[model samples]
Target: MGLRIPVKLKHNDKEVEVNALLNTGFETDEPVVALPLTIASQLNLTPGEKRFYLGPGALVGEVYLAGEVTITVKVGESERSIKAYAVIEPREEEIILSDRAIAELGIVVDLKHMKWWLV
Candidate 1:
């Protein structure tokens, strides 16, 4: 299993805590978090425009650029927030945290133990 961490996502006045996957392969220069349509809706985010993109393992897909939101990673008493661009797709079922997001949140993942801690 992959490393998953509790994260609180906020947009405007709406927010929700979810188990977000820490995907090291989801590389991007800027902080990005991929959310399902349901989460996007709950956050009151409207899908703005469509974009063609490449994903992990060189997979190709289309996703909606649902603007930006504040992503806060919560672990015990440590928490950090970063403004990230939200990628929403109809078929997405999990919140995928990009490599940039993880680094921005000061997350150090111990894949051997499947554990994570904030720095």
Candidate 2:
């Protein structure tokens, strides 16, 4: 039960907007972003969706940035830009911000204030 924030994903200069919950349980050094078949095709990306155990519920994830690209996090007043490790497959859902993303670009998730800060 955490907050779900609207996040944007960009590839090959195209952007897709989606919502994702702020999660600490997601373990990955690389950022995980999802893209649908249509978007992936637009960016010339072909990948597979991964199904794995996330706590108790099986979490299916999409991959992007396998070849290196840009990923940006846009919160209310703050925006952080970073490199994408990969995009998710079957991209029907939102994008999940990886810890590597937050740490690299100095993204501050102000849980108390309900705002994201960047410095």
Candidate 3:
């Protein structure tokens, strides 16, 4: 298992704080944050472009990047805006913060203590 932390997401005037797992498996240039359909709906996001995602064990799935927006995430004492690819999927249990997000947020994963902290 990977490190997970509580993150705050903001879009426009709407905001929601949820638990997000640092997804080490995701490799991409931009930060991608997977949100549930409910949360995405709350943010009033619309699908823009269709995209495909390949997960562990070759779990291939479809996603959309149509709702391109700048979302803010609160790390420790600072907040950073990231251009995130939103995934409005139905069955996801937790939000996923991709590697790019991890680095941008300066999140240090301390596996030995099973903890994560911002630098």
Candidate 4:
């Protein structure tokens, strides 16, 4: 297990709390949050006109842009909310937070201890 933290996502007046993976390798200049189709549906998000092909190494399939959502990350007494582009992945099973998202959330990851904390 890596740095998985509880996060609350809100959009279209709908909200859901989930454990999101803090993927340092998911590099992006803009704040992005990748969610499974089920989670996107839960937040009442619909795929937009924009789509992109993404994968760990090679292109696996296409993912759709689901607009933006407010992501609230809380650890202990530290909490923050930021707008992030939501990407819906049909093949994804877990929520993956991009590097930008982690930075915006002020999370400090300790890989050695397999722990994370808000800074």
- Candidate with top TM-score is 1
- The candidate maximizing lDDT is 1
Which regions of candidate 4 deviate over 4 angstroms? Answer: 54-56
Supply every candidate's count of residue pairs whose N, Cα or C atoms clash at under 3 angstroms: 0, 10, 2, 0
- For 1-119, candidate 1 gives per-residue lDDT tens digits of 89888899999999998999999988889999999999999999888888988766788988899988999877677778999999897788999999999999999999999988989
Per-prediction TM-score:
0.93, 0.59, 0.81, 0.91
Residue pairs in steric clash, candidate 3? 48-66, 49-66
lDDT digits (tens) for residues 1-119 of candidate 4: 66788899999789999999999988889999999989999999987765765668785576788999999987667789999999997888999999999999888999999888788
- State the lDDT of candidate 3 residue by residue for 1-119, as single tens digits: 66777777777777877778888777768877877777787788766667777777979987666465455556556766666767666577677887887787777787778877667
Give the total clashing residue pairs for model 1: 0
Candidate 2 C-alpha lDDT tens digits along 3-101: 566656666766666665555455566765445556556556666445443444675543434344566666567777777665544545544555666
Mark the 10 consecutive residues where model 2 has the least summed lDDT.
Answer: 60-69
Give lDDT: candidate 4, residue 65.
Answer: 89
Worst 10 residues of 1 by lDDT: 72-81
Please give the lDDT score at residue 87 for candidate 4. Answer: 92
lDDT of prediction 3: 0.72
Ranking by lDDT: 1, 4, 3, 2
Q: What is the C-alpha RMSD of each candidate to the true structure, in Å?
A: 1.3, 4.1, 2.2, 1.5
User: In model 2, where do residues sit more than 4 Å from their true spots?
Assistant: 5-7, 34-44, 48-67, 74-79, 89-92
